[model samples]
Target: MRRSIFETEHEQLRDTAHDFFLKYAVPHRAEWEAQGHVGREIWRQAAEHGLLGLEIPEEYGGAGIHDYRFNAVVIEEAARTRSGVALTLQNEIVAPYLIGLGTEEQKQRWLPGMATGELLGAIAMSEPGAGSDLAGIRTSARRDGDGWVVNGSKTFISGGLLADVVIVVARTDPEAGHKGFSLLLVEDGMAGFERGKKLDKVGQRTSDTMELFFSDVRVPAGNLLGEQGRGFYSLMRNLPQERLGIAVAGLASAEHAYAVTAEYARTREAFGQPIASFQVNRHALSEMHTKLQVARTYLDQCILGVSSGELTAEDAAGAKWWITELEWEVVDRCMQMFGGYGYINEYEISQIWRDARIQRLYGGTTEIMKDLVGRKLGF
Candidate 1:
């Protein structure tokens, strides 16, 4: 089914993003995967093309476009190339926090570098003991004489090794329970702020993920984001968009897998004929195509809802888990169709399968999303 949500300008942007990825990311995938992270040069190239900071105001050297369709285009095109650069994290997740909550001075200090890819951003929320339970975070920031002293560690922080600045979620008043959390800006090279080794992952090998440690790191009072004691609320408010972005990427990955597998079935022969001629393969393809179409339609609706400010947390959760689960299922079936060849590391289907596993686990697990939606339905 054709998607109707994007305007002509969005298609043009998609073309630009596709060309940029093909030129910069596709050829370097092997090297990047070997290094366990993409090079900063590609990020700078993307910034040159106006791919970063779409939400930042023009006065701060960003595109200043608030539309989500542009973001969806970048996600889709990046998925098409299988680039594990984490651009969605930069544009979709972290940008909103800064653009929505940062003070004018903070904006002036950070937005330009963010827009130009000089200052990459990462949000540190999950800890070893706390993944979905935001209120259980133990990272603490105590009030000091003109600054706050932060002390804690975060694990599984994407871009941790390369992030120029990290927005650390810390407990400001342990007695206040959930109301005690606040966000502090912790910059690179700050005393007592250090990054641990890059983590080895099952997939998305080209994206950097690591541990971050902060001990006695003093953050100025001006580095505080939004109102104190409202960090949890701010995270909740931005999660819908983050989940929607994940859903879009999941749908795109499924679609790409289906397309490539369909072509492979038509060419790769079994039983002295193309596998696509077999009833089982034909039925599998038909089923996957139908499922992907349905996912795309629903994802499109969610994107529109988000763009129009009508999307709810429950709705985004539904889209995230359902679409990502479907993505994993579709990719798994596609891999099976390739038989022995799909098990090989050289095959893209195998990588897609590996990468799809993490989608259900992150941005809130599938179980967590179901619980969230169920509660919203009063179950």
Candidate 2:
């Protein structure tokens, strides 16, 4: 399917982004994976390339483009190259929240550094007990004289080790249910802000995921983002873009998986003939092609709708759940086609298959997405 969403400008940006990934990211994949995180220099290199702040305002060291398709392009290419942490997520997932909700003083203090890669950002939302149930989080911030005393724990935080500033979600008023939540920015070097061990994960090996502990960590009143007790609403507002981003990567992974498997099938032989010549292999290829094409068409339209501010949360949820689930399915089936070789780390398919597992789990689970969609339908 032909995608009409991107203009010539976006196309040019894609080419540039693609080249950047190939040069800086592809060569370091193995080392980064071995080190358990991407090198910090890559973040600086990306900032030099003007890839970190496309949505930020011009005065704040960004391109000032508010369009989402440009953001989508960066994520798509990053996933295509399997770029590691602090590349795609910093720009697409975490940056926008600060851009959209942070105060002018906050923006002045953080945006320039963020764009220049002098500062790294991470959002702390998921707790050990609460994944999708935002209202159930027990992390609390009690009001003090001139600041808030924040004490809590956050697990599964991306960029946790490298984050210079973390936007933490906590309950400001325990009895208010959803209305009690708020967002606070806790900077590095703050007293009593302790980082836990980097977790061992099944995939996304190079992306640092860590646990964070706040033991009487005091955040200044000015560090609060938006209205106190309004963080849930704020989270809800931004979740659509997050889901859209996941959808972008999910389908891209599917397409890449299919492409790689197709190449392998053509070269590997069975019964003195290429596996690609077999009817079973041909049928599998046909099905994968059809599924990916349909998913791509839908996701491209969602990207356009998001760029124009016409995309709804329900629409994004549907795309995220359906497309990522499809990515998991296609990658698994494609892996099976490789026989035992698919399970080996040396094969790119194995890595992709492992990496694709979180697609259905993160950015809200497929079950949560369906529930959101169901609620939008008045269920």
Candidate 3:
């Protein structure tokens, strides 16, 4: 399908992103996975390439481009290259909170380094006791004379291992219910702040998932993000863009998986004939192609809707759930076509399959997304 969402500039960015990933990320894939994370130097190189901070204002050392398509382009290129550097965690998830709510002094302190990749950021929301239920979070921050004393832990933090500053969601008023939550920035090297070892995960090992512990970590009052006791609402405000990024990643991964598997079927022989010549394989590939085309058309419309502020929470949730589920299905089918080779780690198809499983699980699970959309429909 012809996508009308991307302009000439987006294509130019796609080209640049594609080249950078191929040169810098592809060759490091094995080493990063083995070590459980990408090298820190990659971020500096990404900054040098003018790729680290497209959405940030140029005054803060970024391109100042607010368009979501630029994000999609970077995600697409990363998926194409099978590179998992967690760049989206920085650019897509954490950047918006700082940009949308940070005070002038806060912005001055953080945005430039974030743009230059000197300061890595992560948002700690999921606690051991709370995944999607914000009300259930046990991480508490008590107000001190001039600062807030934080106490609790976070699990499943994507960029926790190397985050220079973490935007932590903590409960500030036990009696205030939804209004009780607030965001606080906890910088590295703070006393009693500890990071657990890198988690061994089924996939995305290069992305650096880790556990974080805060024990009476005193954060200055100046570090409070947005309105105190409004972190839940702030999180809601950013979900549309975050889920949009997830949808982009899912679609790109599925497309790449299909592309590689289809090419393999054409060249790999069966009974002295290409496997793709078989009716079953041919029909499967055709179905996948048609579905992907439909998905792309819908996704292009979503990209435009989001950029223009017309995309609703329900809409973004639907896109995230439906598209990620489709990605899992498409990759699984592609793996079937590869037979035993698909189960082997040496083949890229196997990696795609492993990574695709997390799509339906993260950024709010498919079940949660459906419930959100369902509730909005009065169901």
lDDT of each: 0.91, 0.90, 0.91
Query: What's the distance in Å from true for residue 372, model 3?
Result: 0.5
Worst 10 residues of 2 by lDDT: 84-93
TM, every model:
0.99, 0.98, 0.99
lDDT of candidate 3 over 130-235, digit per residue (tens) = 9877679999999999999999999999989889999999999999999999999999999989998788999988888889999999999999999998999999
Q: Candidate 3, 359: how far from true, in Å?
A: 0.8
The sequence of per-residue lDDT tens digits that candidate 1 reaches over residues 1-379 is 7778889999999999999888888999999989999998877889999788888899999999978889999999999888776798889888789999999999999999889988898999999999988888999999999999999999999888788899999999999987999999999999999999899999999988899999899999999999999999999999889988888889989999999899999999977999999999999999999998888888898888877999899999999999999999999999999999999999999999988899998899999999999999999
The deviation in Å at residue 221 for candidate 1 is 0.7
lDDT of 2 by residue, 1-379 (tens): 6788889989888888889999999899889888888988888888888688888788999889888888888888888888764465777767888898999999999999888888899999999999988877999999999999999999999999999999999999999999999999999999999999999999998999999999999999999988999999999998898888989988988888998999999999989999988998899899989988888888888998987888999999999999999999999999999999999999999999999999899889999999999998999
Minimum summed lDDT over a 10-residue window in model 1 is located at: 80-89
**Whole-model lDDT for model 2 versus the true structure?**
0.90
Candidate 2, pairs of clashing residues: none
Clashing pairs in 3: none
Compared with the true structure, model 2 gives a TM-score of 0.98
Comparing 2 with 3 on lDDT, the higher-scoring candidate is: 3
